[model samples]
Target: MANGWAPDGAVQDQIDDTVKDAVLRARGMMPSGDGSDECDDCGEDIPAARRAALPGTRRCVACQAKRDATLRSVGINRRGSKDSQLR
Candidate 1:
């Protein structure tokens, strides 16, 4: 049963929505159009393998890893208090 008066599939719907949001966010982050031969950040040459694998990759592995590391973490409060949800 769902907590409080939420509908039968509310919990599952929340989970599905969270996954969908993450997928959309990832897709938005993906490179579009043609990839360059050089890393956008460091100007180092992007490997052919990465360009082929990702299709539109631009940054080298190291630069990309650094950029990924700099991204802020997003947390879902699955266990948020009912009072918190009310606000």
Candidate 2:
């Protein structure tokens, strides 16, 4: 069932797109290091515990937190194209 004047599958497609976008965003946010226990951003020694908790972590926890905050502010785009129109 469509809501308002939207098509039947529009809402579902939006949901799927939102999920995909989130997955992509998460992948991009992932650390891309070789578990060196070195902070890629500041070149400081990363703690062993931190390395274990977040494998492949490139940035320090503080830097990563700051980056995450910036990402949250941008929000996500939900435009629907024909490719997205298929649901």
Candidate 3:
């Protein structure tokens, strides 16, 4: 069933696009490339095991935990909800 101004699959397309965008965003957050021997935030030495385990880590566990703690949810509702808009 087609809705006003949209084709049959328009809503589904939006959902797929949103999922794709979220996947891309999460992938971008992951560390990549040849990482560091030390923490990027602190001067603490990154362990060999951790470096090998994560493959591309720049921060030690403690510093990374602090950084993760400060992260906030910035997601926006693309579905046009009044509650989301108010926030």
Candidate 4:
């Protein structure tokens, strides 16, 4: 059945677009490998272990946590199908 403003498939398309936008935005947020030891947000020292684990890490653990918490995630298909969304 079609909704007033959106067709049946149109809602799915909007969802897909939203997912794609979220993925692109997340990719853009990936920390770059600038080799900076200081946290970009807090200016704290980036631990050696963290640096080793995340080669391209630019934020310290605390800063990274803050960023992660602040990060916004959109509804994306986990199973590549709408069945998952129905569950």
TM-score of each: 0.83, 0.63, 0.71, 0.58
Runs of candidate 2 with Cα error greater than 4 angstroms are 72-87
Clashes of each: 0, 0, 0, 0
Q: Can you tell me which runs of candidate 1 are displaced by over 4 Å?
A: 75-87
Q: lDDT (0-100) at residue 40 of candidate 2?
A: 66
Q: Rank all candidate structures by their lDDT, best first, as comma-separated numbers.
A: 1, 3, 2, 4
Candidate 3 at 59: error in angstroms?
A: 0.4
lDDT of each: 0.87, 0.76, 0.86, 0.75
Task: Return the TM-score for candidate 2, rounded to 2 decimals.
Answer: 0.63
**Candidate 3 local lDDT, 25-51, one digit each (tens):** 878888999899999898899999999
Model 4 TM-score relative to the real fold? 0.58
For residues 1-87, what per-residue lDDT tens digits would candidate 4 score against the true structure? 566765588767777888788889878877665667887788888889888877788888777788788866646553356777567
Candidate 3 clashes between residue pairs 3 or more apart in a chain or in different chains = none
lDDT of 1 by residue, 7-82 (tens): 8989998899888888988899998999999998899988888999998888999999999999986756665779
What ranges in model 4 sit over 4 Å off? 38-44, 67-87
The TM-score of candidate 3 is 0.71
lDDT pick, better of 3 and 4: 3
lDDT of 1 at 19: 88
Superposed Cα deviation of residue 16, candidate 1 (Å): 0.6
Scanning candidate 4 in windows of ten residues, the lowest lDDT window is: 72-81
